[model samples]
Target: MKSKLLLSWWNDLRLKNKLMILYFVAVFIPIALTNTIFYTMTANYVRTEKIKDLKLSLEGNKDNFRKTIDSIISFSTVIYTDGSLVGALDHTYGSEAEVLTAYSEVLNPSINRFVPMNKQFYNAYLYTDNTTLIHSGMLNFIDRETEQQDWYRATVAPSRSRKWMIYTHSQPDPSYISVIRELDFYKLYSTYRKILKIDILPEYLQNTLFDQTFPGKLYLLNPQGDIVYSSEENLPQRLSDTVQQDMTVIFSVFDGVDYLQGWQIAGVYPNSVIERSLLDSRKFIVYLTLANFIFPSLLILGFTRSLSKRLGLLFKGIRWVQNQRFDLLKTERANDEIGQLTEEFNKMTTRIDGLIHDVYIAELNRRQAQFNALQSQINPHYLYNTLDAVRMSCVTKGEEETAHMIKLLGRGFRRSLSWEQDMIPLQEELEFVMDYLEIQQFRYGQRLLHNLEVDERVLDIPIPKMSILPLVENACIHGIEHLECQGTITVLAVQSGTEAHIQVQDNGIGIEPNRLVQLLGSLESSRSMESYADGKHVGLKNVHARLKWHFADDFKLSITSDHSMGTTVEIKIPVSLQSSDDDIEGGIHAC
Candidate 1:
């Protein structure tokens, strides 16, 4: 049912409209669908890839941070195992100077060597309860206040099994994640009581924990969720409150148990940065969409218009042929289907024109032969007998002018018999009419006057024989023949741009307006063989029809007359119809 409706709609549309619809369907729709799918899949892929990349970078930074803590633990363990440091801490000095010598040799040398060797270290200190044994790197007198410190109590606690604890030290310099260990190696009672503290620089710890590749705030929290370090310098100390406020925020946490137990690194990435990265991808998608859809759409539109324009020309040619206007030719410039169709149309018009020409010439010849037969068989013998007797009698009475009129009459009758030529030069046709007018002048005497003004350049133009002469005769017979005063007839032919204008003007009794209109209407409507040979205005009709058919309607004949004034007949034909010198000479021979 849908197919039937679509087919009906398609049939109702014009060819160009149908082509545009098809182009949108076949070309544009698929492109749009493909771009939509590609953009969707690409966005998914890019988001997934970005998340994976961020995860990898965060993991790599965590590994470096864990390694730094492990290195600090390893250095503290090495310092703890040193026999010299342990012996020095356990020694009972004989004097203060002796104690200073032992401390300077063992404690100061060991701590200074390690502190200067590592940029990650802030300082190292050995705290002891022996006030009399003073050393450069050791806290010489441990008081009750120092014993209350967190690192000091954590290190000295008897039940503490853990070898390392992260704590801050403020003595020589503030330190982040300081490793502290109690120094107790003697089994018997001993006076020396000490603790070792290895300090780590906060800057080094931050550099190890955070990565520039991961664009966001990173927090290093202890096992109890206290933020010990953060990438954002201006961030508040309480990170849990910040995370809880905005639910849209996405973050990841890594617990550090393999290397530095009870530590967690949390990374929070801002949505704006992710959105900005996606915006870049969206821009890329838009560019791809334009390249994929817009450019091809323009190309398709151009192709569709070019096809429709050529088809439109073909349709116009068909319409012209249907209207019987085959003279306007179609040009085929391409070797495509439409061009081939145009070529076929041009060939058909040419064939039709050839057929029309052949038929028109054959009909004209047949009509001429029929007219000649009718005249000769019906009235010629009697007319010749009557005219010859009158001519001889006039000669016998010494009326030379009357005899000359008879001779002119005979010449006219004979010239009318020759119907072999269809076209004649303007020069010869005018001469034929002038001879006939001279005969009429003999009868009218001074009452009839005529003038012929023809351009020399147009004299040799080949027009249909008897085309203008008939108009001249009509002007004289119907217009000037019954005038009271001297009636004047003028024939003019001159070039008017690309056309030749030939006019016959008479100053005599003119036709009534209505009659003139009716006569012209008859000439316009009359195209049949019967109308050409039968009407009272048959000569004019024949001239008009012949000029129209010969010149493909390029020639026009106009008749204008005013009652009691005059009548004028004008003919305009294209200059292209003018014969060349050779054609003019051939036309003369034919005439």
Candidate 2:
């Protein structure tokens, strides 16, 4: 019973609401939960990896510092054991000139060769206790002030052969990592003590050795735990006093080297640095979560909208049918069930429209038959006899022009009343138009002039009856009736390839631009005949409709006019060469 009730409730919901509920439960909730868990795991993993990378970078810097110190020690060892250097320093000299000559030739040449080979070697000097040796380049006399220095005291201690310490010089004030080695290799020949001090470039140590990709502070501490080198700018002589509790410290101790035995490289990292390292990962997770959420939502909305829109159209179609309107439903090119239903609906509407149209046509034919019966009550022969009598009376009274006009008027009426044939030879249509123009000429004398030009080849073409006459009447009534000057009407017929071209042109006050637009629009509209008859441009609309009924799209009617320069109406129709021999002979003769 519960299952059945649930199913009933589900069936009672609208399609869009049902789809939305399914999406929320199936897609939205599941994706949101999984993405949240995935983002948490990713952030933790990225942060752990960043901390490991920082530790490895600190170890690498420690190795670089060891290598630099070892290189300096190697260079100092060479200077300590050089026999030529020992001989130059131990010589007994008489005057300062002899000292200068021995110093330039022996000591200067040797120092220049080694110092320029490395960018890290700032300067090298030899300090000695020999009173006879002058204080000159690369040779310094060990005065009482030098003996008081810590580096010198450390080097001269009894069994210490070498020492590395950061020392400050007074002349050019900067601290440098100095290497001091005792020159005791020639103990048998020398009675004096000598020391070699080489200063390593402090800028090279600060800029190159500890420059790492990790965003942390690095410090180089000597065995005595003093801050010797730091990567921070404007650091004091000691470490900062305000160390936070959350700061992480990593240490890499130097082993295997006797001089740097207890020295260590220390890295200070903050929690914020680790978080910064995971910034890109966090952004990626956010974007992924949004994509998972938005894309499925858009797809669900699109599907629901498509279903609802088509169903709405179907409901609208049913309402139209209820109101007795058999309008065909427009549908998409789909192979779904809805498309099939729409197709069947359209077919049903088409059949109903056909049945109703047949009934309407039958009723119209019945009414036309009754009207024809009423028209046939009048005797056309009696009307013709009366018109001929009038013409004859005018002739007897010596009114020849009035008699001729009456004869033409009778012929026009007879031609209009006769509708036995719908299609007539082009020659007959032209004759009818000429008769009408002659009557119009009588009405507008001296103000209207007309000309006819016909091509002999198109004289036998079959055209609908009264097609050319309306166009001529429209030209005379609209084009020339209001002209202050004399108006000229030209009718030109020509054959071009497989078509006949006819034009009716007039030189009079032309239509205004706005009015001409309306006239052309009326000709193109698919309005009822009754509406067209009650509105403007009735003659052009009639001619356009008749041409369309006969030839469909094969015939063309176009109007071109300038504001004050005349209007031209041109018609084109396919030429048919199947007229009777008598009609062809008549057309040729008339042309």
Candidate 3:
């Protein structure tokens, strides 16, 4: 009972609204729930552990850096106070060769041979104020060039003696870190104090810091907070300005006291990188939970869309049927129940279309047979009058034109009985009209004048039988038949584009505008001959209905007139070589 109620409620909602609800329940709820749980469990714990790790990492780097600096100091001390190396710088030679030999043998050997405990030092230099000493790789004269340098000036200042300083080394390798100290052991101030410089490689400095994958940057800075060395080239010069405002910075002084006077290490942890790492660590759980429902959600969406699309198509087909259209549904057939229903719908429409066709043909034949019977009765009555007129003409004129009148009557009767085909050639229809006119001419001599002006090209096209005859009859009986003077009837046939036009023009009494409007209005109001009143606009309405029935709505009959001038009845029908076979009944043709 609960399941049925749930189904009833779901069915009551629209398809798109139902899909939206399903997505929110199946996809969004699980995602939001997983994220909330994951964040609650790990958010603070991850941040605290990460900051602690950064501080510990920076402390370790500081300790190793201090040890490396101490080794440079220890090596510098041995070279600073060497008695033999000092004597070589102090000795003055009379010849350049003597100076070169003494320094190369003593000064160069002392500084070069003394190896430090740490392998980080790559090279060493001694800057002396001896004018006669040559500038070899190890020993160089402290001339005006050395005095102008900041390192030289800082080292030679009286207040900075016996203290170590760090600076970037440019020679041999720019990646080198240099440790400098001034020599203050000599009592003679004039001899000029020497500065000792030791170069350390970048590889040794990098080993003391964390790897590149670390979420923060590590650097060694002096007491002034200027970066002396960094683990990576991309490291920010100032942590406070370069890092985010919420970023964590861990700093500590060096553990080795003598080696690094005020040098320290700093680690910068940007909040963005930390949060990203924390999210990455929690991705497996969140995705695993979401993965379980993704396929099912997609399936639901697909089913909803399919059902809506099929129903939409079915509704469209029903609307078309309401408009009397029976075109078959032309969509792809699916494998589900809707597909079966669609097939059944197409079959039903086909069956209904066939039934409508059979019924329409039956009704059309019944109307045609009824019209023919009426026409036959009129012909016999007209025949009796023509014979009587002939007999009267014989008695008065002594049979002078009896044979001619009888021949015209014979032709009219023969054509009237030739209604086996509902459609005949335009030429034959014109011939039949001429025969009738000739008979009428004998009765009212010199009062009725009729002429046929038909284009030869339109003579061969098929038209509904007796289609043009009614228009001629209407022109004769309503128009010329009531005239006081000589009445003229003109029949004109021509082909205009895809249509054939046959017009009957009379020069006699015409209809009044108001009455003419009523006559044309009747034609417009009812196109079916069965609705027309007997003997009232029967010829005009019959011509309109027959043409309309045969050619659907593509045919037209128009009547135009002037008050007492004349009347023109024009009929337009589709030009065709042969009539449609669908109108044939049991090997006989019907319109």
Candidate 4:
């Protein structure tokens, strides 16, 4: 055998593994060295660093913008704190007036001028709790949820000391901030407190960082996620777009509210400025990286001349396999390790070729014997043929009971050989078993009971025919056949996604756990079993083998039992491996 193997191995066209491994490394390594491990990684690093630097500069600009905006708020607060303006502004809170009379004596002309200087600051409204707009530089106020929050409402509510807070308008803008001042009107009016509000716009926020030095806009966001100030000429546009939308940041203290609110100010540097800054650095680093990577990889490739030659020969051998020429590998390489491997491979193929022929013959003989044994092993065929003749004679003599038994047997046989197929639609297969159960019921009377539960949706699904019946028959004969009292069989078919599963259960004596393990072992180990009388569970073993033949590991068969609760045999077939809905009826197509 060893001499014949070596001789056969000499002629095979397959390449040995050592050459293929070298070929794979040659093809994959240089590409990764140039693109992934070297060039792309460096580019990614440079881009990340550029973005980080730009973000830091933007933060610096934003702080300056916020301080400048705070200047306007501080200035307004000073005027409101003064003895004269405070009295007039304070009276508006908690009063039910639509507009409070600003006595000409108490009016500071400069303070009035401050409210109209910018478009963002133009519309200021002060509201008292009793539905009064005591001060207005804008339009009419509407009745709506004030978007008041716990901390915000508390700050602006009338109190003994001072309450100061601000919120933006319901409408959004990047260049405006709304300021609210709480009033102490509850003592004077004895009913409620009111809030004093003002809108501050973009120009008031123009500080050193918001000046011409920065590349992008600066912004202030109010507690309600509304943009109230920006340094951009297109401030409103940027606020409406992604930049402001992305900045509705929730701080660490966002547990109680949907979102926490306050005045959040920001400055954005234009993307073009930073991108231009990186161009020369980008070019210098890119060239240096390519220089570092390409030269070394090229040198390595040049030095590995033997590896390249071996791979080229291996490629030629693969091309031969692709064309299905499994014979006679002609090579210039002498009998080194590659030649020895090639010799061993050729012998492996010749052995498989011979084994395939022998296995096919063995399978044919087994099927022939299986057919012969199945026929001769059961005495019911002779009993059925004689019973039918006697039943016809009884029918001629006008005995109805004998005629009924003959009819039931006829129906059983008709369904058993339906289309002479091994598999049929699940609906039809159940009908076949139910027909046989009728014959048994006639013989044994009400002592035999059967329950079948099947999902209606799975009716047209195809399954292995006669497969379910053998288990039920085994339950009836091998299990409960001794009991003269009562016995039950339950056949269940359930559909789970792509699997069409069938279960046959009977309330009879079940096999012990150890014996069941052995039974399963015999079915799984090999296809060739000696005989049906192998003291194993023959019918179940056959079903397991057929399922394996059709679906391989994609199919599943399991049995679970109780000595009192009977045995359940279940089959699972994967959806992807199933045949087409049209072809599933008549043929078993295994891919």
What order do candidates take by lDDT, descending?
Answer: 2, 1, 3, 4
List the candidate 1 regions with Cα displacement exceeding 4 Å: 13-17, 32-71, 87-113, 116-120, 127-137, 140-162, 168-175, 184-194, 203-226, 238-257, 262-295, 317-329, 333-591
Q: Write the per-residue lDDT of candidate 4 for residues 1-591, one digit (tens) a residue.
A: 998897676545343443444544764455446655554566557667866665566666555545544655665566545655445544444544323345344543535556555445334544544443333443223234453544355554456243455544434444344556654434454344435566555454554446675555655565555555555555453345745432322212122322223445554544555556657766876676667567765665564565556556655655665675555455564587766655555565455556767999999997997697677635556656766787789899999876877877766654543334555677887887887787778867777899999999788765665667777777887666766568888888888988878888777777778877776777676466564556556766666666665566877888887755577888887644444443333332211
lDDT leader: 2
Q: How many backbone clashes does candidate 2 have?
A: 0
Using TM-score as the yardstick, the better of models 3 and 4 is: 3
Instruction: Give the C-alpha miss distance for residue 472 in model 1, angstroms.
Output: 72
Estimate the Cα RMSD of every predicted model relative to the unseen true structure.
16.1, 20.2, 14.8, 28.3
lDDT of each: 0.75, 0.79, 0.74, 0.59
Model 2: how far residue 534 lies from native, Å: 99
lDDT of 3 by residue, 471-506 (tens): 777777888778889999999998899998888999
TM-score between model 3 and native: 0.47
lDDT of 4 at 278: 58
What are the TM-scores, per candidate, against the unseen true structure?
Answer: 0.43, 0.39, 0.47, 0.38
lDDT of 1 by residue, 550-577 (tens): 6767888998888889999999987667
Task: TM-score winner between 2 and 3, please give it.
Answer: 3
